[model samples]
Target: MRDAEEARTQPLGPQGRLGRGSVAPVLQLLSLALFTVVLVVILVKVSKVPSYQERRQEKQKIDKEMSQLKTGIAGLCRPCPWDWTLFQRNCYFFSQSKRNWADSVIACQDMGAQLVVIKSVEEQNFLQLNAKNKGPTWMGLSDLKKEGVWQWVDGSHLWFSLSNNWLPGEPNNDGDEDCAEFRGDGWNDGKCRVEKFWICKEPAASCSSP
Candidate 1:
């Protein structure tokens, strides 16, 4: 009995010590691996956070620039030749030489604008009042696509009753004249081939400062 108990106790001493020693190494290694995994995950997240922040900042700057552009019309870096012409949030070009309606439209498009499309009653009045000296300038209004039906070159409807700005019997589609011209009172039908002054317009909001 004494010998068996001693044998059993001897086995327990070595086995317990070995198990404890082996378990400590395994736990240490497992902890190190877990810490490495956690560190790698944190590093990846931190790196991506900066990229997201940078993109957000860039978007804010773009929004600010757009707002600034909206509030103010681009200022003149150079003097405009049409001294009497009034322009707001836009650039205007009065044709120096005469051209047919089609040619004038093409020229305006080449300059990155269509013929002038008046946006408001005030704008129409302004154009008309100034156009007397301009001698009936070609406007954006035309029946080029569909005869007898008027439409702005920009594809907007001309609600005549809103501004009520039109000459007597205006847009009569008289004869072969399909093009429209702006005068002091309002508009008049005219021949496209007829030589007259023309207006080119570009939005000021879109112009970048030099």
Candidate 2:
């Protein structure tokens, strides 16, 4: 019984100490591997942060430049010439002097434009409003080529019939009335040689710096 107690109380031998020391080395290796994995993950995340910030800043700068370009274009844009009114994409000039239809055409040509051609109700209304308190005005329309067929100075056929806006009983061909005129808000057939104020039209100038 004494021998048994001595064996149980004895210190561990070299073999047991070697076994315990080996286990400690293995545990240390495992801990080092885990730390390396964590460090790699942190480095990868930190590397992406600057790249993401750079991309965001570049996108913001591009957007700011685009906005500035649009503002510059708007600032440079001009709508009409001096003494002219702007409507849609065209510029208009109302004459203070009277001229016959043929002479009016020549005058508009000299100004690098043509007699006004009414394309829609809006344009017609605009012309009428501006011509208020003025006498009859020559239009770009005439049936000189064929008495029954009206055409604009640009040679485009008048698609809609005169009944849409003509004065009552007009174009009676009364006394060789081949040219067209605007009196008040309605159109009328008048002699081509009659003197009248007119309107000239041209495309608006390009947007540019003065």
Candidate 3:
């Protein structure tokens, strides 16, 4: 009887515990699982940091390249050769020597350009300003193909209806006066063989580097 009473009052082993299993071992396993979950979360966050930094740096590099490209394009748009003047997308060369209109055309062709063609009031104004105090200069206009039918050097018909830079009472077709010249801020028909200073124009060359 004493032995039976002592066995009932003794502490139970793991396999003989209440309900499903031992509470201490279950608690320890739960704590270990929690610790593992926290460690995994911390490792995931740490791994993402480098990825975020790399993405940010890539974006900044792209932005910098874009900025440089914009600056390069702006530089490319205004390329002009040395000793030449830029106007819009074209370049102009003012001669320091005099030549006949025909010889002037040949000279410009040799230089990879052509005699200047007046296309706008602004261009005419610019030419006039540059011609200040200078003597009459040969232009690219002529009615050599047919009298009273003027044309530019490029074969485009002169739009007399839209605009005519001819001086008043001029182009009278007087005595083989087919070529044009700029004088006193206006234009006049003149003999092609007459020598005068000239202007040459051509498209601006593109820059090789950005």
Most TM-score-accurate candidate: 2
lDDT of all the models against the reference?
0.77, 0.87, 0.84
Q: Using Cα atoms with residue i matched to residue i, what is each candidate's TM-score against the true structure?
A: 0.55, 0.61, 0.60
Kindly provide the TM-score of model 2 when superposed on the true structure, using C-alpha atoms: 0.61
Give the candidates in order of TM-score, highest first: 2, 3, 1
Q: What digit string (tens of lDDT, one per residue) describes model 1 on residues 70-106?
A: 7655554433334223377666777777787888888
The C-alpha local distance difference test score for the whole of candidate 1 amounts to 0.77
Off by over 4 Å in 3: 1-78, 207-209
Estimate, for each residue in 1-210, the C-alpha lDDT of model 3 and write its tens digit: 999999999988765676455577899999999999999999999887768779999999999999999997777655666777888778988899999999999988988888988787788888877765577988788888999888889999877652466789888878889998888867888999989999899988776665
- Point out where model 2 deviates above 4 Å: 1-77, 161-163, 208-210
Badly placed stretches (over 4 Å) of model 1 are: 1-86, 161-163, 205-210
